[model samples]
Target chain A: MKIINFILFPFLFSISTFAAPTWYPMPAEAYKFGQLYPKAQQLLFAFDYGHALVYERLLQNRGLITDPKEFEKKILDAVMKILKNPPTVKVDEDDIAPLYVYTFPLMVDTFDWSHMLHQFVLDVLATSKDRGPAMNRRVNELFIDYKKNKPLAITDVCKTMLFMDGQFFSKDFRRQYPSFNLLIWSYHWFQIKLYEALLKPTKAERDIAVDQVTNDFWTLISDLPDSADFDMMPETRKEAPNFYKAFPLISASFDNNHMLHDIVSDILASKKVPSSEMRKNGIDFARMAMDPEAFKSNNCGAE
Target chain B: MKFLALAVLLCSQMLFANQKAILVNASPNAQFYRDLILKVRQSGEFTLPIPGAQSSLTYSFDFDQPVFPETLMGDIHDSFNPIYFFRSFWDKILFKDGSYLLINGEKLPLTCLFVSGQDNRFSDKKLLSPLLPEFVLKVYLVANDFSCQGPVKPGWPATGGREENWDTYLYYEIKDPTIMLPMDAKLRYRWNEYSLVLVDRGSK
Candidate 1:
């Protein structure tokens, strides 16, 4: 037994020594405002569920509803249930959206990376007493750090609808399923609008703004695809002007992120792109979105 | 005996390298960071178990690399390659698997669970300016005690910085000539108050 113990020790030790992949936690001070801003935090978590659930359903064709209206109603109903009682912890998106994750791993990575930045930015605003120089510097530094992951980071440069809608595969998802498309836009809308709310000078005022924004989001989705609240996708510049003005780089990044979401959905939904080529087209679309040199189009602002 | 020796040899060849740690000290602009570092420096002497037995350990890190915090945030890839962002500084400590610290003639054991790094240079060149001028790196020593029960509860103190993981924060900003990075550190031994400390060599 002693001989066996001695023989196995070094091998066991070496086996344990091999490097296992581990992730860095958000900055030491991150998520400080979780308790302070439950409503916003919970909503963000729900939005995550909504994204994962929709992509999985769309990409996998789980229910196989042929009619567009039926698909819209079923998806919207399920998503609303999730939003009503959102998961406490972040949904492990891979588990929910396996096909989408498998099809476009890099695209999913880009979204997750940018979404983390979004959460961190909100925390920065929520934890700080006021939107002062310190807050501005922190936000700027976060943005600077956010672009470090070259393959995954979305370029903050404003992309034209030409890149998003002009492609042959573009607009298929929205055309086929307007309600789900609009639901995603509403998610983007509430995200930026919440930023605008958090930017209010005082806590008392900020609280009120949050409630108002939440109420407005509920109102916007009261009716399904036919809801008259907003026919067009909400742009950051239009929806959260204050947040956009205060942090232009972040605002542009949000717009770019939303555009990428639309682009990916369109690619997946379009039958023009063969199944074998969906992965390739997705990569090209993502690369175009990440390219900083792509010139902007004035006509591309969320209509 | 021969078989045991061959197994040992194979293990040594395949396993980790014993790399010496070099710490750099960079000052922080954030007030929360400043406070966390200050508290650790003032705490004086404490001991922790390394690989084998209890030993005194002192930590000194220099984070003076020009890398911004946001850049570190970007480096976090949720999938396979997650450790690149913390490798620069944390790897140094990792290389020294079991170490000791003596602060003011008291023995303390220094233990670390994780380190991560982020570098912007690994990104696309087209996005960078001709005079990129600045190359920045940030590394973290997240000494989280996993023993803390339940998930991280949301309602933490609003005004101060909260460690994402469990308690007992120990930060050190070492100006050690041997380890040459510029980083300011903070260590908090939380019964729940936020503070940071700096170690000037083993002299405390």
Candidate 2:
């Protein structure tokens, strides 16, 4: 019996390992970034925090942490502050730990890459003036080097670029939870637009614009419910089509990206709702969006 | 010996009886859509095989029921993939699976399935007259299997941008086949979309 058990255990383990699902990139258009800039990284992080805060609130509520609203408010405040005053260095160790636990392996070691990319962009842009022709030549060389070393596939690159265009959707994330996915996408767009405003050459104008936008974006997102109301799925989508329309390439890459965001939020917010319930809710929302007859019958805000 | 034989026959019958089915419904409200699925399952209109079946199931929905003209169905298909207009960041997650189930009879070649509620809203109901039969509850079993990793996480310099991962499966089902309408009429209706992919064993 012991011998049989040992053999079965290993075989079972192997089956489990193999059964684990794997994720892949969607298309080349998903990863294009015309110009990598410092503010872009900040914008991305701000969006991340926005998503994180939502999940954090949900998880805290689930954990019996009273006053999730307070924590949510604090996190939103922090996000606003960051938007106003972007972080200079990569995220602090403490912040990374929470994010790591929430996002897990995907977020692991990613900050370093983001920081490196930002620094590289800053260095190149700073030299563009002094180096003139040399700067231009060096920029081309850097692009080539980055492509070769950290080469994102055409689809990946296009997805990134498409983010800039603000119209294309990410196929992967969109497939799983369209509402939450759109919320995150909208957050990204808000950040991108804010970054563009802040990156303007005039420092004074940038600062003022950043503060205004940050305040407005926070107010907009804060108005959203802590948990997704499954009944209101279509109404939410109709009201926020631009948010959905904005990030197609990135959305296509993974279903779990959006799922995890909600999962972690549920955990952090201490929402008692089971993961299965959340998943089912997401699936139903997806079906409603796919059915043409249903779409026509339902009013998504527009008459 | 006779009792033993009867027991074996009964066990075999039970084994063969095991079945699995997935039903998906969509609404403008995410919470409502979720509840609708639960309601449908509880209502027992469909029987799901226990011990789970070897095969997988999927369901999909579209929330934005963009109304297109019946006259332009051919033009829309000839010029571009109309799906692109409705495509958004949220749509990516649904396509993680290679294919999806079609609720209507409409035969969709692409992996994704489109649904909308807007069809019932049109004043001129005749627009959907041509394809009404094909548009009701239909199912499509995909011939190919495609697998991929989740998207790379968007970076956040403040917390070190994190990457995320997920596994997805796509399948389709046709719910109503009697409703036939022109391609343009079909595209004109708006509906909320949703989908379900069979998670591999132990995925939960």
Candidate 3:
């Protein structure tokens, strides 16, 4: 083990020393949705912090959680604290989890790629006029262009069965970390709900709808859900039904991605894995989830 | 096009109003501000730079418009320069921070300042707001900063991804009357790279 660490330490340092520039073409509708409804974006701003902070805290305090649920509670408290006054700008993720990157470099890239999809949808909806026909074309164009670059696209199928409490899954992560998991679920709950706003034609109508959704998000955060209670991961088909009709494949991918959000968290927080091997375990789960046959789901059961 | 004329008109109006209403112990050129505001309001692009020491900070702005997207650094040129660039933050870290803030003295309630910036292309621990007067400022919107970060990632269109460290901020500038405010409508640093694209999100 010592020898392996010595061999890999320099590699990590060098990779960090000379990294590639990360950027993307801002979708044509970059900040338009936010301009249309500032509060909606603010909600997302809070989630960005929550999302990154979760990975940071989990990795920072790996193996400390003998009581996963209790730890999840603490994490929720932290997320709510952040939601109260989210940072006005994005914080450096690499800065947040520098040491962890030495091990889980792949997770960082996958997270960034998935995040771009989230922002891309908001952009598409921003340009799409209240779920009009143009919505389909714009979304398709973006999906095609985005897929062309792939941007670390999660092509494999990470089925719901993988997340089941089998031998691989344990009580430590999910049973202990319910609220934190729910917080993520809740973050996603609103992610799909955001599309409903597009159904409204004008800015004022969209604003009113977005405000309602924003209010809905705050309700969830302020009244944290019961521990280990993600209440079943949100499905794009169920949440974004209109979108489901338009882009079934893409929509399924998002639901799969959301499920993996939990899967990764589950594995990271599990008591089954030793603290030292958590990164390796996370990568394993990431790989399995990336496997198209395993991760991709055309239908995650009717319900 | 009309903002300059409106600015001049607003200055004159402030002068007129301040002289006419002597009830509040008005400052010497009290009317200049009101006139400038009215003129700006009259002229269409109702963007105003915060006056005083902080007002001098360089700024570059890009509205979320529909058009071809370009890297912020790419878009920035001789005619359009942001008040603070990536290097500006670094320079401040090494030397004295160049950002100016005279708001403690009474100025029109500071509200929502939207700054367009970049993120870390490399290692930089400098977080601008964490070091500033945090109590006085409330940050509501921060993107491009967090969304684009971490290991070998692909770039996207319109932005210089994680490598560029491009970010944005919308802060609520508190209105304090104690501050000695500017009389003219020029709301940018001395270099003045771009016209202020600031909008009134609301006042503090």
Q: Give the Cα error of residue A112 in candidate 1, in Å.
A: 0.6
Residues A228-266 of candidate 2 have per-residue lDDT tens digits of 233311221233243223322222212112232333333
TM-score against native, each model: 0.54, 0.27, 0.56
Q: Looking at model 1 chain A, which ten-residue stretch has the lowest summed lDDT?
A: A14-23
Task: Write candidate 3's Cα lDDT for B1-204 as tens digits.
Answer: 599999997887676556434522322232333222121111111233344423222222222221112212211111111121121010000001222222124222111122122122111222222112111111112223222231123454355544423233223221111111111122322223333322211111
**Best candidate, DockQ-wise?**
3
Query: For all candidates, what are the clash counts?
Result: 53, 204, 69
Q: Which candidate's TM-score is highest?
A: 3
The best-first sequence of candidates by lDDT reads 1, 3, 2
Off by over 4 Å in 2: A1-89, A93-99, A110-127, A130-187, A194-303, B1-204
| lDDT of candidate 3 over A106-151, digit per residue (tens) | 6666666666666667767766754667777777776665556454
RMSD of each: 23.8, 28.2, 19.1
Best by lDDT: 1
Please give the ranking of all candidate structures by DockQ, highest first, separated by commas: 3, 1, 2
Task: List runs of model 1 lying over 4 Å from the truth.
Answer: A1-25, A62-65, A298-303, B1-204
In the range B128-186, model 2's lDDT, one tens digit per residue, is 11112211212222211122222333453443544532222122222222111011111
- When sorted by TM-score, best at the front, the candidate numbers are 3, 1, 2
lDDT of 1 by residue, A233-287 (tens): 6788888887888887788888888888988888767778787887887788778
